[model samples]
Target: MFHVGFVCAEYRRRDGDGDDELVGGSGLSRSPSRSRMIKRLESLNTVISSIWWVFGFYWIVVGGQPLLQDAPRLYWLTVVFLAFDVFFVIFCIGMAFVVFLALFCCIPILAIAYAVASTEGASEDTIRSLPKYRYRPATVLSTFNNLGMEEVLGARSGLGNNGSSGELFLHSEDSECCICLSSYVDGAELYTLPCNHHFHCSCISKWLLINATCPLCKFNILKGDTLV
Candidate 1:
């Protein structure tokens, strides 16, 4: 009996020791993985910070050198670009604030407006039933008229010699319309802007209607026009 009791005690002690070792092993395994993840996060942060520093240094050198060299036009051009950037950022912030107010305070504003309109004998139903605003086709035509499209087109036509093969031969073989990515095809109608850059008639016409500039080079097509 004494021998059997001693054997049982030894078995229980061994089991307790085994359980403690298993718990310790698990903790040890998890600690290494946790430390590795932390190290990875720290490395990523360092890389991002380094990239920003390089970008800032580059811009400072590029933007500051013109001023140091006494080039007033380039300096002022950079300053104007920065000023426009500031205005653009402010405009974006203002737009976001307006959208937030519209989303949250819309019901209150609409209610107040409706109450005032109703007092002035305008019915709520009539206000709700009003048609949504849309841009007119004449707006595009008016913009073209303002840009003096006729004079610009006539000048462009006179500059480039008409190719008899229906394919416009560009001076450079590397020439490709930046818009469509395709090389000017044989039998395709093309228009050469004053900048000497050529594009398909349909592509340049659509683009010029929106903005009057060479797409490849941003030379203003209306720069020489006194009426523009």
Candidate 2:
């Protein structure tokens, strides 16, 4: 047994010495392939993160303050967005559909419709029109899922902004749930608005089945609601 162990130890030492000699001769203290791979991965991550941040910031800024004063800046930002979209499309073919969206297919159509609807006064038209777009709604999926708008806005909900999970937030305590006849508990389950009302999640889920509106205010839950 001692002889066998001795032979194995000598074999390991010989192998270690050969590795050290090869490394020293090549002057490669670490594996070249690993270093190259890490550098390539880091470069790719930087590009993707930059794309995400630039567009994300533009979306926040313009969407928050949509005014003629910033229109030119917004236009250039849109160009950057388009360029990023092109790169994204190359890498993610599924995202190529966003090109059509960038073309103003849906938003422009809605904008024109809204413009014609309230063309009586331009200032009033601008106020209404701006709000129509300034807010992006939180997406809700399944209708059966009882999660709140915060979850969707936080991007925890898998549904995209334009998808079914769209709704606005309510910031009034005057709103009451008829089922409970009480003011909402902070972080309480609430119904979405323009139909600004509150309800327990369980109560609202059951209520929606029979009637998709707030019982106290008769505000519609399934439609015309904005998520804050």
Candidate 3:
């Protein structure tokens, strides 16, 4: 009797297996687990692709223009900025990009600033929130004392009027690139800000993207104003 029961059980197992196959073949039994896994993989790929795209752009920018160059300070600063720029581009898209980009850009600006601040004679300066003023194109050329604008002039401070601001004057057509503080000969390329402050084109471009303020007086360039 026991032997017979075992044979019957075996037959039942085979029959159950066949029925399950038939049901699957007829599409009555859906493989929900496989479907879910495929969808999850696709979503993950999309996220990864977005991140890759952002970093690619960020690296191109960093490689094109390094902050410190041969200076020891440049290495760590570069790492910080690269990480920040990549993270900014990845998570921040659309209007949010502007905010993250501004923050990432500050990494370099502050790095330069801190270097200057740490120097023996340079005064300590902190960037408070910039005040908003009306945009006046005329102020771009005028001096800081003029009404069209106030503050935000020159490359370095203490070198402008009394030669005590960040502003540096160039007598040699190639004397010094105000932006990077490197010597430039004629046709080296420079950008003259509304404040009559000159800098390397790339340097000023980086500055404008971050603050739209003059490195000298904190003038709001986006407001159609200058530091001069």
In TM-score terms, which candidate is top?
A: 1
Task: Please give, for residues 14-89, the per-residue lDDT of candidate 2 as tens digits.
Answer: 5665787887744345445545554566667678777886777677566745533577687567667767776776
* Residue pairs clashing, model 1: none
- Per-candidate local distance difference test: 0.55, 0.49, 0.51
TM-scores of all candidate predictions against the true structure: 0.26, 0.22, 0.24
Sort all candidates by TM-score, best to worst.
1, 3, 2
- The deviation in Å at residue 108 for candidate 1 is 30
Order of quality (lDDT)? 1, 3, 2
Each prediction's total of clashing residue pairs, residues at least 3 apart in sequence or on different chains, is: 0, 11, 19
**Worst-scoring 10-residue span by lDDT in model 3:** 122-131
Q: After superposition, how far is residue 58 of candidate 1 from its true place, in Å?
A: 50
User: Model 1, range 67-142, lDDT digits (tens) per residue?
Assistant: 6478878666766766776698899999999999987799788987875543232233322222211111223443
- Model 1 is weakest, by summed lDDT over 10 consecutive residues, at 127-136
In angstroms, give how far residue 180 of model 2 lies from its true place: 1.2
Please list the Cα RMSD from the true structure of every candidate, rounded to 1 decimal place.
31.6, 27.0, 27.7
lDDT of 1 at 115: 55
- The local distance difference test score of model 3 is 0.51
Give lDDT: candidate 3, residue 117: 45
